[model samples]
Target chain A: MSEALSHRDRCAIAGIGATEFSKDSGRSELTLAAQACRAALQDAGLTVADVDGVVSCDYDLVSYGAIADALGIADLTYWGQTGPGGSGPCAMVGQAVAAILSGQATTVLVYRALNGRSGRRYGLGAPDPDARVGGRGAYEEFFAPYGLVTPGQFFALLAQRHMSTYGTRYEALAEIALACREAANRNPAAQMHERALTLEQCLAARPISLPLRLFDFCLETDGACAVVVTSAERAADCAQPPVLVRAVAQSTGPRVQPGVMYPMLMRPDITVTPSQTVARTLFSRAGLGPSEVDVAQIYDCFTITVLLQLEDYGFCAKGEGGAFTESGALRPGGALPINTAGGNLSEGYVHGMNHVLEGVRQIRGTSTSQVTGAEVSLVTSAPPPGTSALLLVRG
Target chain B: MSGMFNDVAVLPLMPVEDDHDTGGFFAAARRGELALRFCSECGQLLHLPRQVCFACGGARSEWRAVPGRGRVHAWTTVTHQVHPAFPTPYTVVLVDLEEIDARLVGSLPGEAELEVGQPVRVRFDRAPDGTTVPNWEVEA
Candidate 1:
């Protein structure tokens, strides 16, 4: 394997900011985007006028030019949009890093804002006939006739298979939900903060899909999150310490088709996925391992995803993620503190952008729930079916 | 007035083309067998077949008839139908093909009992015009 790129060769996240996590923002998505961008610029000791590039997901309600104009950005030299849902944020970071490395732009802003909680709830399973531009339409046409429409229903099938094959009980899965809730208790910004939830409470929660309780699912919050990325050289001159991008990679699984069965099941390798391939590449490139990571902010759209990521990232062996997560291993002061800002399970879901912001906070030494001497952090996504790892050090 | 009445009558049965690719797909579905185009150079199977190969960017491709036999990779039993056209309670399965290393999502027969690796064969239901959609059924 090739040596990982040095911190100086790539870009660093200079600032991270977010709107208040709530059920209702009462503002438009465009307004949320602007607020988050302005706050991030303030955190970076710069103004919106300093930003020369922008990257976001294609599904975002606000356009890049609109956000730039709203924020009073003079002109954008580089703009990128990613396809997959949650994967957009990490992919944007990858694009920003490439833009900075290639000299296309000096400073790039990455943001995700949505009215998912108050406006459009993703949990309500339905196929929009108007969404006929991509593979989603084809999948819907083929599968909707048979009944698989909701994401939870689709994932529940996978969970059922795991339960049968690995003897993973529903209670064991509930443990992950409980642990995340306990972590959220320490974070004031978390939606479920200070609300101690027991396994019984999690089990008692209403079922969206069989084997998936309301608590097992992530909250849909009306919120926006932004991060500022610049060249390591510029980061050195900035006010906040840079959370350098150590190594980044993305991969697709063997299924070779979107919403396909081979990749989803019968692959005989659900425990370790293509996301792990990216994780391994990242660790090898950076010359670091799971042990070296001080904090991790994994995509927690569902608890099963987190368990699978743990194994795929080599945090534990295959089928051992259940045992690995048991006994508060993910809690603060544990062996490896993960999702310190309350994961999507407890924190607001901004398509895992908040996870990235929390990562920057951990490195900046300003996290509300700070981990002492945190140096390296890993942020991931569950969409576009990929993972991107960054190694940050105190500079 | 006659033309408008005829247009309203034809609207329900009108063949709506979602995209250019769907046109090609419905063409293949007219035949009893199911086919997916695979790049001859890289041997990569294309789903929702496009004009070119996404993997190797190769242009030359050939259509091959597959047995349409596969194992259920993942599935969900949906109890709610958000769309007016679809009825409540359906089964959707991701089928992993044995012929080429590829997977496709399709509706499975609601009455059939399915396991993760259950064997299935392809069945198509004729829609409006000559188009037939590919569905799955348990192999006898």
Candidate 2:
């Protein structure tokens, strides 16, 4: 779908860093951002002076100028914030690649920092007066009056439609939950690392929304993850093997059937995600298909979101996501591994920046649950709206 | 605030803001009428009220009354009170209007079930402050 972006693979992720994912950092998001940025710069064998551009997703409170000031970097040329939600990590990387290739800036650092738990939980309604009553508050005005809020409720509607149409069972969703938790148990950094989760446990978990249980929700975490994207030329001199940015594209679906929180009503079907546009363009731009992907770090804001992404991204046929994960296929020792670092379910949610880190680790072969002979890793953002994805190859 | 005949006692967790783009729609709902954004240039119906029409990019649009009837497109029941103001175990249904290619997210009485494609009709449930809010029910 994208005929341009011809400079594909011209830039690469030379460094990756993160503060530990947790429930409370006991500090400000600004401190968390600086720590991650310094570690990433160090990992790249480059000092803060080398960084000229900064990129991050919108929800992150720290501004690029604030970060640059914190890092004591004097020369600033490029900076940006990708669109809202968990869909911006890879997009930020893409922006860095574009900026570096165009010579707008070099040594671009991308990060996501938040006190998601200790400060502001995304699941809770915004307590601010402006967000609740100002012009942009139309979002709240239209839907909140009916108690139709929260990401869980929104996805629940999408999940039920997928089930009613394709006969997807609750167990299918349970398998996804179980696999992510199992992977988390093996990864020490995962918040639920020690907790054993079974199908029965998931099924018995209290329902948050009728079709979704507590386990289906992503943990509200506090932390930051950062990566440095630079030119392939500069990356060649870095300390670590660079993960090449193979291809990247972003697009949303036509508003056919607008939902409360999401404007996607006019889409041909509810089960289909806006990721379709990105997936098509991503595979086309990379000159690769789903089979070429060695492993995946699909966004898992909820268990059902993973299923929708699997089908939308062509990992499996639509409505076949349930069977796709039934065999522990998404597990470490399975056919197709997913969310190796425990994902949002087991791992802490730093918005979606951790997904990109996992992608880089898989290509680097440094993953705690590293896949065998992994080469190309696919990373996707939350879908069914303006979704985005990136392909990382071992450089 | 036209319809004062019946009032629902449940106060909404938040207030619905009706401005230049949406005051008419909300006013119609208060008067027990369902209004959609109709594009004069393309003869298309837009929703959620915007300045420019999605189709034809028409800037000239007006509110058009439509029958308060439709079918359940999809729905969800919230069992968790993510916000203390929001009551637990409530249902929200997105209705595909019979009059046009648009959808509306509204509430249904706690007792009703929401099956996809089930026929439904629009009704009003006033907030605790007696603000009339549109809702839905299964068609008889």
Candidate 3:
């Protein structure tokens, strides 16, 4: 396929906006969504009236039409919802790009809002019993009975395997958490702002699951984030400098089924993951490599996830992430400054939406803890069964 | 299988449907056995068994019996209990079956003794209903 078909002639993120990271927004999810949407439009020098398309994750209770109606945007030409939690941000951006390229709409607004901290907590356990009764409940039914109910428990198992197989240490994982905390200390909007964590502190934190301390997991927060995507041509007319969407791709691995391990074991390698497929495809399409990335906003739902993604994205050789991260490679002055906005670990988890906003800020040179001279950014999401990568460049 | 606890309220009993067929999950107890359905036309083993085959968009499907022998693909010991239904410090396992291309999840009777890739056989326990719910026992 031509560059235009593969990467060019697609949508660009014209503006990005977010609510201040908080443990609790003390407001409804709908209100949070509207605030972020309005802020994004203001940043783009556009109005809510300019957005003709909307896309979001499937789990969001708020519907596309509801957002459009609340934002007072007239007739939406395109609207879509993608699955899996953390992957939504990247997938929604891709959907918006596709919508723009296909002429379905000229301006697409993608947003995510969650009261994950104060409201219903996903980490608590399996889906509600009502959800398990129907066909949709099949996957949960298989695991819930066996007590593999929460994401933390499920990922902890993977962490144990990584530790047992590669001798990865809990202290090394704590270092990753510390780096994120130190970075967030410089970010005024980070939920854990100015709260520096020491290895001792992390070690003292209560254990949520074996091999995963409370600090190792992302924070539950009530927040919202939104981004605007429009044609590159339209972006030129906008007020702020645009962040070109150089490439965007999504992929699924051999075992697409959630909570199943057959495909994972059948694969030739346990360390190498399908997220690499997304990264490889994205780099090839964007004509960039790991060295060229000035900054990265990797999804850090869990520290192990960040480590796994580092390997899968070829930032380091497989199983080398523990050591790579331990060497301070992710620090601001380091080779690849990851999660400069503190990431899900310290920045509060908005379903990885804030990471996308941080990417836009890095290119704009407006981040609170900006990576100086940064021109290119890599944003990745490792939703179970697959990964999504997006290459964004400063315009 | 004979000594397996059938009256444990903690254990959940449900049916397994062929990925291709969704008429209803075949009734299985904690130790019961049933085959996954497949599309006769497409030969595709269905999961989350539905009324119609997702492959080839066909509707015809039939279940075939197979020995419930498998190996552990992955397992986790949950040390904390977030839900009231489950007791803390239990083990959950994903087992890859030999006769079918699918994998299933169940309690790891004794996870400390079980290793990854260890052989196991399905042992069905009688449920409140006449059907059985499938659980696993390490092969002798």
Q: Which clashing pairs does model 1 show?
A: A146-B91, A261-B94
How many residue pairs clash per model?
2, 10, 21
> What fraction of the true interface does each of the listed models get right, in terms of native contacts kept?
0.17, 0.55, 0.36
TM-score of each: 0.84, 0.94, 0.87
Top candidate (DockQ): 2
| lDDT (Cα, tens digit) per residue for candidate 3, span A77-191 | 8999876678778888999999888889999999999899888787886445333321343344445555566777767767776776677888878877887888789888899
lDDT, residue A330, candidate 1:
80
Ten-residue stretch with the least lDDT total in model 1 chain A: A130-139
lDDT (10s digit) by residue, model 2, range A216-321:
9898999999999999889989999988999988877666333324555444477888787789989988989998888999899999999988888888898898
lDDT at A275 for candidate 3?
A: 79
How many angstroms is residue B47 displaced in model 2 relative to the true structure, after the best TM-score fit?
2.0
All candidates' chain B TM-scores are: 0.75, 0.82, 0.75
The TM-score of candidate 3 is: 0.87
Looking at model 2, the pairs that clash are A255-A266, A256-A265, A256-A266, A256-A267, A257-A264, A257-A265, A257-A266, A258-A265, B10-B128, B11-B128
Off by over 4 Å in 1: A1-10, A129-140, A253-272, B1-31, B38-64, B79-88, B97-102, B106-113, B126-131
> Residue A54 in model 1: shift from native, Å?
2.2
Q: Where does model 2 exceed 4 Å of error? A: A127-138, A256-260, A265-268, B1-6, B14-17, B127-130
**What's the C-alpha lDDT at position A368 in model 3?**
79
